[model samples]
Target: METKQTDIKLKTPIRCIVKLGGAAITCKNEFEKINEANLITVSSQLREAMMFGSSSGSVLEMDWSKRPGMAESLVKVDDYKEQLVLDFSSFVVIHGAGSFGHFQASTSGVHRGGLNQPLVKAGFVATRISVTSLNLEIVRALAREGIPSVAMSPFSCGWSTRERNIASADVSAVVEALDSGFVPVLHGDAVLDEALGCTILSGDVIISHLAAHLKPQFVVFLTDVFGVYDRPPAEPNAVLLREIAVREDGSWSVVNPTLEDSDKQVEISVASHDTTGGMVTKISEAAMIAKHGIDVYIVKAATEHSLTALSGKLRDKIPDDWLGTVIRHVS
Candidate 1:
């Protein structure tokens, strides 16, 4: 039965929503060191993926600082904004504050409790400034790539929500951008009051929300690790599940639990301490979205062919046995 289910296929080529994890974008060993080489590889693949779509990009990033590095970079470039708009010709982008506001706000404990605290006002201001700076860098990078990207904040788009509202808005923004012939980019950032309160929003959650809204046929989650492991790779006998089904009911049961329960059962783990949410959170989020009929692939950002594999065109380039965890929709 599991084999039959895994073998099922979709009748059409659905749109895609790719979520690039911060861990994938930034290095886990060193947060400050941007993985330029890895990013270039991912960007190259993303460019390839864009060819398949009418328009592709990201949601605007929230402002993190009163003065942002990206903003400054943009200012350094003559007609940076106009040049960017002319590059891709049409694209939408969303960015998260990354360390800009999160590091400071989290440390200050301003919005420590949630979005409703009076202290949140300070946190909000700090995050806005930080996000602004982050956006400037992103805009500059995209310009260099000739990707033609734009940055927008949740505050400006009226996407403020208690918790997941920002994510919903991000998805809406992506759809709008695509409709308008632009790609949308989005990132994890701080949101005002909600259950999680002052905690950082997970990029995985952002991607999941987008999948739910756009029903992108394929969802790719790029992280630092190679892929979902049955056990931490450091442990003996740890194996990769390769593929799993996410039942519409939101369950991640294995096909043959007893076959490798001791070595092949997928375990939830965190890639780093800075990551507020870990593997479990990502899996749960992706599983929920899969229930809505989207297929998700979680792969390591460092893998040279990661994006290509997700695009269904890198099979020949990768080892014949190479495979990543596949989360499917099982009703």
Candidate 2:
């Protein structure tokens, strides 16, 4: 769903919101297949960043050499007390359906709703089964890292939409969870709808809503691509946009390339099988968050650049060596 997930009080004040792109964790082309390596890499990097900040180090001695972003660098913090104290408190993590549910949802036309139809109804169930399965895996990975993470499924949490746009949501659980110092992990899932019987909710939409109310210090999107581009990165002429400024009027400007998008649209590509809009949706949701003066970073997964971004160490600026995009209000 797309809008009003209205309600979350500032407890510790979220340091940032992280949205895990499904494509980055799963092989989208294969049905229900998780890119185990990428998922491990992302999970390890997240744990490392949250615990160690920018300077790399691991809490585990044996797994230090096997960890993801720590993939090649065999980091071993002999003692847990020696690690740097990083501010990774009060943050939320949201992951997209990716290969887990997208195929089932798309095949069943579940996003458009109409559970009255047998196929739609069946698909809805299948979609939930698949997505929830992925959600559990993510939570388990975080748990292994001892993150104090808790799963908060949106559909079961009173998330409903009207025409695929979030009409209202009850996120008190998320608030309580954060207040309790537990990292509430949320995922995009099928939700009840007003206009339609039920619809698909994307992580992008959820993060946008959270950023609007929580006013987090920053938001990070870990995706398969390096960052937002003038066009699909796969295209020969596509150019990576290092920085973009979303204006109050919904328009945006490209800081590095010196371009303007008056129509609130970019020549981005959406995967044909995606139940929810793809990169375009991510950009749109990101723009929504940026308009509120919250900076959003989009970077590739399983890379050192992503490691740096996830570390949340460099808050004020994106270094010249970074391969990512920063979206914010220029003024």
Which segments of candidate 2 are over 4 A away from where they belong? 1-8, 52-88, 259-265
What overall lDDT, based on C-alpha atoms, would model 1 receive against the true structure? 0.55
Cα error, residue 50 of model 1, in Å, equals 1.5
Q: Write candidate 1's Cα lDDT for 260-286 as tens digits.
A: 353234656553334345677678887
Score candidate 2 by lDDT.
Answer: 0.82
lDDT for 92 (candidate 1)? 28
Q: In model 2, which range of ten residues has the least summed lDDT?
A: 57-66
TM-scores for candidates 1 onward, in order: 0.71, 0.86
TM-score of model 1 relative to the true fold? 0.71
Best by lDDT: 2
Tens-digit per-residue lDDT, 39-127, candidate 2: 88888777776653343544333222245455485544455566543445677899998889998898999998897899999999999
